[model samples]
Target: MYGIVQGVGFRPFVYNAAKKYGITGWVNNSGGAVTIDLTGDICNVKKFVIQVVKNPPFPAVVNKVRCVSLQYLHYDDFNIKRSSKESDTVKFIPPDMGTCENCLKDIMDKRGKRYRYAFANCTKCGPRYSVIKELPYDRRRTTMNSFEMCSSCKDEYTTPRDRRFHAETNCCQKCGPSLVIINNKGEIQKCEDVIDETIELIKNGKIVAVKGIGGFHLVCSGRNKVVIGELKNRKKRPSKPLAVMMKDINTVREFCEVNEKEEEILKSSKRPIVILRKKENIDLPENIAQGQKKLGIMLPYTPIHYLLLEQLDVLIMTSGNISGCPIEYKNSSALKNLKNVADYFLMHDREIYVPIDDSVVKVFNGEECIIRRGRGYAPSAEHMEVQDNIVALGAQEKSSISISKNSYVYTSQYLGNLQDFNCYRNYQYVIKHLTGILDVNPKIWVYDMHPLYVSSAYKKEGIKIRVQHHHAHMVSCMAEHNISEKVIGVIYDGTGFGLDGNIWGGEFFIGTRADFNRVGHFEYVDIQGGDAAIREPWRCAVSYLYFCGYDGKFIKNIDKNILDAAIQALNSSLNCYKSSSLGRFFDCIAVLIGLKNFITYDAEAAIALENIIDENVKETYKYKIRNENNVFLIEIKDILQGVLNDINCKLNEGTISAKFHNTISKLTCDLVLKLSKIYSISKVVLSGGVFENEHLLKAVYYELKNNGLEVFFNSKTPINDGGISFGQIAVAEAVTKKQSRE
Candidate 1:
């Protein structure tokens, strides 16, 4: 058995199961794989194997189990032997798990040995990826090695009957790491009751930076408008929604409409921030999520978080970094960087080796779509049955790295955009960190085709393969489904370097990973001030208006100076590039329909547009498709004209947004059907970040399915740039094979 078996109580589970079936030998970790040697009755041994496979540890992912007829040494009973680190394949390190229910009860129970202990955890739950230094996942390989376990705690660990038997992270108040409260003046407050003092400060609406499992979170009372406003102001985040940490499902239901699926995801051990629709006229402060209709809510994942939430109803728990920078994990860094933002600090002694942010997820079409894969969801390998010794550097935005081993591509956590110097450094660090931990030395390096990309510039000592951006997006969807056959891929996202040397976003391609042909795409429009257009949606709106043959006089209510400059740029074609980006199209529509013209973050305008979608409005605007030498041009000028007519008719933004979305969806089906007739391809693959919009995906998915076409979108891997690395890996292998054949 392999894959996340270590550090997740799999050994104990095997021991318990073996004992139940009267199979005797030994079970131990050999690098990444769990080795079991047993000799007993044939039926009992078979039952033991079945039980092990059927009911492994909660967090363990048993990828494959192999049974062999071994010359077993007869033993009286089963025993967990010392782990041996002797294997070519490195073991998978489990992500930090949320505190389990039993441990929660332990901390709450007055008579319990770990009562009120902030670091109380067992084998089933606690920090793993964050604190881990090396493999075999023993106590010494973790930060817990610094803390000497007390006799009582040691007894719980060594006792086979105990739930925490061989639990590497088990600790009590007397032996484990302790917390300290620091005042606003950078002076340590001599307080015995740190939790109580921290709770009191937050109750009074004072913001506190609390050290958590992966990093520090700036927490304040969510109900208090002043505190929430202060947090937003200090963080330099105005309209972006702040995630809230609730006590339990009951508190979450009070503020947000909790469906059954969302409730389960919130309570799951991963404990990702589940984006839930807010209850109409909820009793919470409006400033908590501001203009957004949905609230990002998460349950306590750590013992300290649980302890804090036990007293508080709701807290505005957000990453403790000054917006745009990576999360603050080091105590010294948190104390120094967050001094101005947080009034007080609740810090712990336990060191976090890796800085992992909280993961964010949204329920889409009854499936959990990961927006930000971090914390409890990361450092988890996405397996692929491919050749080893390859590394794929992900896209410039939402960066992550993928290392391929025998049939497994262990992708790194959500490394922020490589655009920032600090985030670039984070990307570099994670590449080195993950490669070191996974013991991977790549012989082949894969990178994006864009020359200016920081990831492409990395000096890797290997054969390099540069893959086209949208092809990688399409291939990523293919790789997730393990598809080898060619399919019609409709890739829509912000931007990607096209093979024809233009910025391609809305793309239609038909092929396998080896090669792809651009069958059709949206007609190119001039992008005035390349990066500048991305920062401000108004520029895109003006560009689209100009493309629709609208003069400067048509740009009423918009800034005259900006409009004039954009028009000048478009007329002269100065510092302007052609792009067929669907993302830019959305941005243009978002601004045209009276959404935010300037964005504080990436995809802000698009998100606002998606949020205001009126699902009941099924009417789609007319669109034109013309084939130019087999490359179909999807003209959106007519769609924009329809939108203008709707706006002139005083239609609300929601209705316009609905019409715009439906038009795009219809256009997708129309283009696919046209291509299907020509290429005889029926498999339609939807990929890229634009598909992260559930409304658009659902519309396209159901429409294609109803039309007797098989539709496949990304489920295992991300549809965004986060999954680009995996696509890079797939393309690399396919290209290599093709080259070898040639």
Candidate 2:
């Protein structure tokens, strides 16, 4: 049995099933798979096999089960044997799972051995990928090997009837990892009850750095604006939204509107943070989400979190790291780096072998869309139809790595942008760690085409394949949908290197996974000061106005000299590159309609535009698709002029935002329809960061579906740069197959 069969009570389940079916058998974990040997009546053995495969444990994902017949040797009874490490073909690694109800009950039971234990866990839940150091996941191979189990725990492990039987992370307070409270000065705080002390500190508006299953989190009261503001100031994160951990589903419902799907995701074993629309006039601190209409909320996924939230309704549980750094998981590093940001440290001695961040998700069109894949959702393995040892290093931002073994592709959790030295180092570490654990020796290395991408600069000895960024995005969706036929892909994002050596984001491609033709894109506008235009929306606004023959003198809160210099640079084509980024277009509109003149985070302007849309408005602006040299260019001058006219007319910001969003949706439908008709393809794939906007995605999805076209989107993987590595893997496999055939 393969596919998440390790460390998930699969052996124990098999033993129990064998006994129930009156079969004598032994089950053990070996080479990342479960091996079962049984001897009994043929009918009984068949029933046991069916039960094991069809009705596995709660969290065991049985992807493949191979059965073979051999000369049977009678055994006294069913037995759980020790694991073996004799093979290199590893199939899957289960992701870190949230705490199960049974474990929670044990922690809450006053008479239980693990009462109030912060590290309460069993076979059903608790750390897997984060604490794992190698395959054949046994206690000795994980970080828990450092802590010895007491006699009571050993008894439970030896007993087959106990749920904790053979649980790798099972232990009581007497032998398990213990928590310690330390002040910011690195002095130990002596308290009768550490949980009570931590709760008091949080209630007093003090930030606490709490160690969790994967990493440390900077936690505080979500209702306190003063503390939230202080946290933002200390962390140097002004406008970026912070995620809040609510007490339970009821608490989440009080602050945000939750549909059935969102609630199910929140309560799932993979408890990811779900982005939900905020309830009107809620009492949550505005600093939690800045001015955005949606709030990122998650339920407690760990025993420590549940204990921490016992006296609080909601807590701001943001990543514990300095600006531009990966999440801090080490005890010494968290204390040293976050001393100024946190008032106290609620830490534990449990060593986390691999650092993983909480996954972020949102529901779109009644399906889950992963924004950042991590903790509960990764080290994810997907079954593909290819056999090759390949490695794909994703794009610089939202960096992730994928390795292929046999016919399975295993993707690492989300590693942050590679621009920061710490994040880049972590990225390298994850690649080494994942490849080492999976025992994969790569024959092909795939990377983005952008020359300056940190991932592209990674040196390795293998056959290299360079993939275009937007093409990777489009193919990622294609790979998820398992579509090989020709389709029209509307890939839009902030930035990507184009075939002509220019910045491309708004793109229209028609092709399959192996190859694609860039048939259309938004008209190019000079991006004055290059990256500066990305940081300051006013520059893009000025450039758009200049290109559209409109004066930007009315734009306020910007230096006139800087504006004149930018316009001069645009005219001289100095320090300016032509870009067709729809993200930049949103930024330009945001400035024109008085939303923001500058941004503090990636896609801030676009997010704000989406947040303020008036859903009642149904009007759209006019756009033209002009053919130049057999390539279609989406002209935005008319759209810009309409936005400017709306501003002159003093239209409400919400109405203008809605109209602008509607215009983009209309133009997208029009373009996709035109391309689909030309190519005679009904399958349309949408993949990019720009589609992360729920409003725009809903508009385009319903429009295309209503028009009788098959629309596909990335569901299993993120649609952002995080999914690029998977796409690279898919494209590499396709290219390899095509080349071999030729």
Candidate 3:
């Protein structure tokens, strides 16, 4: 057994299983693996092994199980042996899980000892990665070590038949951490019942910073628009959507459309925030999710959350952080940082070892794409077959890190953008923590080709290799699917450092993990003001218009001074760089179709455009591809001209958006088919942040699959820069092995 077998009561489970099967055996934790020895009748032994493999503890994720014959040294009975501390820790750190159903029942039972216990947890669920300091995952090595179990809890832990037997973090109200309510000045309040007081504050429409498994969350009543607006104003968050913690799946269905898959995910053990489309005329406050039609919602995951939410309809649960800082984890830090934002604080004495944000997900084409991987989904290794130790420093935006050891890739939690000081510090801390915990010394260090990336600045002693951004995107998809052979990779996203010293985004590559050739790409356009152009779409709009041979005066929506400056900069190529970014093109179209010329957040323009896609319009605009010297250049002048003509004819933004999306999808499909014929390949992988757009993904997926091509997409990791570390690991490991052979 490889995954989540340590902190969870796997040994006790094995002991019980052995007793039931009448087999003599010994079980113990070795490094991170579970080692078992059994001696008995062949049939019963086989039954025991099958049962162990099939019915592991609810929190245990058994990746593989192997049996080997050993000379029987007769033992009278099976027993749990002491874990070996000399070996390197091989067990994966399971993410903090939501309170399990059994634990919930204990909390609800009035006569039970655990009734209303806010920190109620069993072996099957509760904090793991966030509480662990080191591993063989023993009780002494966790944050719960200081809290000695009460006599009653100890009795339950010692009994083999008890559900709490050998539960590492087991505790009752008498022994476990307690809740504390504090006022705005950080002074403890003398409340008889902390839960009731916290409920009263929230019911009165006051913001409270509630300590959770991972970190603190600023919470307010979800139904109160004024309170929600106040939260937004205090947090200095102008437009990004806020997530709501509903009472349950039933409450979610009332506010948003829930397919079976969405409902299942909402009720899952991970309890990640799921983005669902809002129902028509549902009358949800528009300020909750300002610009988008989708609502990010989650169910109460912890005992404290359930206790408070049971008294209210819903709560606005957002990470407790200022605009650019990481989520506050420490009680002192929460009080100091959230003093202005939160009116009161609901805190606990239990410490969080590592801060994590809530994971976010959205269903696209009936599959889940992880927008942000954290909390319930971090520190878990995905199995992969590779040689040597490797460290992959991911892209700058949506940054994360990964380490490869013994055929497993352990990706870190969501480390926010590398630009902010606190986020970068967190990134470094995660790197050190992962390396130390796994005892991995990477022989190869991988980074993006972009020289200015903060990740690229990391200095380490290894065979350093630089990978192109879009290529990493494609291989990230391939790694998730476990593809070892070559495929056609259609990579589209924001900007990346191109091999030719230009910014590349829209690209098609044909190759394996070791090497690839860029077979096709979008034609280059100038990004005036360089990085500044990303925040203001009008600069890209001007560049597109100029390249399409349109007069500057035609762009009347932009301010006169800004337009004049942009045109002059474009003509002179001043402080401008060439880019083949599909994202920039989308920005141009978004502005041309009358969306906001300026955006407060990244991908706002593209998201706005995607939100209004007219599914009824099936027509695609024209585009021309030029194959000069075998370097295919996809020119979008014809497409832009058609869009301009449509604008002149007074077309709705939805129709224009649909036509634009369809044009790209058709162009990509046409390119893939043409290349498939030329190269004799049938497998295609779609990746990059742009693929997060469901409309384009579905359109291209149908076209390619209908044309008899096997399509692959990202499932394990994100399609954005967050997945870049995984791709870097795959490519670097392969490249290192190839070089060693040479």
Q: How many residue pairs clash in each candidate?
A: 1, 0, 2
Candidate 1 structure quality by residue, lDDT tens digits, 1-742: 8777888888999998888988889999887788998899999988988888877868777888777786757799899999888647546878899999999999999998788899888888999999988777888888889999899989989888788999998889889999999876789988769998899999998999999998899999988998899889999888789999998899888888888898999999999999999989888998786678899999998888888887897889999898788888988888888898999999999999888999988888788887788998887577776778899999999888888886788887888878888888878888888877777888999999998999877987889999999999999889888889989999999989988789999999999998899989999999888888898888888888888888755344767887887789899998888999999999998888778778888899999999999879999999999999989999978999999999889999899999999999999999998898899999989999999888899989999999999888886677899889989999998999888899
| Tens digit of per-residue lDDT, candidate 2, span 1-742 | 8878877788888988888889896888887888888898889988998898988998897888777778868899889888888555555777788999999998899998888899988888999999988888999999999999999999999899999899999988999999999998999999999999999999999999999988999999998999999999999889999999999999999989999999999999999999999999999889898888889999999998898888898999999999889999999999999999999999999999999999999998799989999998998888888666899999988889988887888888999889999999999899998888888878899989998888877999989999999999998898888888899999989999988999999999988889989899999988888878888988889999988887767578888888888888888989998999999999998888877898877888888888889999999988899988878999988998888889889999999999999999999999899888888999999999999988888899999999999999888899998999999999999999999999
**Which residue pairs show backbone clashes in model 2?**
none
Model 2 global lDDT (CA atoms, 0 to 1): 0.90
TM-score of every prediction relative to native: 0.97, 0.99, 0.97
> In model 3, which runs have C-alpha deviations exceeding 4 angstroms?
66-74, 86-89, 551-558
Clashes of 2: 0
Clashing pairs in 3: 32-90, 32-91
**Per-residue alpha-carbon lDDT of candidate 3 for residues 436-516, written as tens digits (9 for 90 to 100):** 778787788999999999987889997889998988999998899988798999999988999999999999999888879
Distance (Å) between predicted and true CA of 522, model 1?
0.7
TM-score of 1: 0.97
Provide the overall lDDT of each model, using Cα atoms, as 2-decimal numbers.
0.88, 0.90, 0.88
Off by over 4 Å in 2: 88-90
Model 3 backbone overlap count: 2
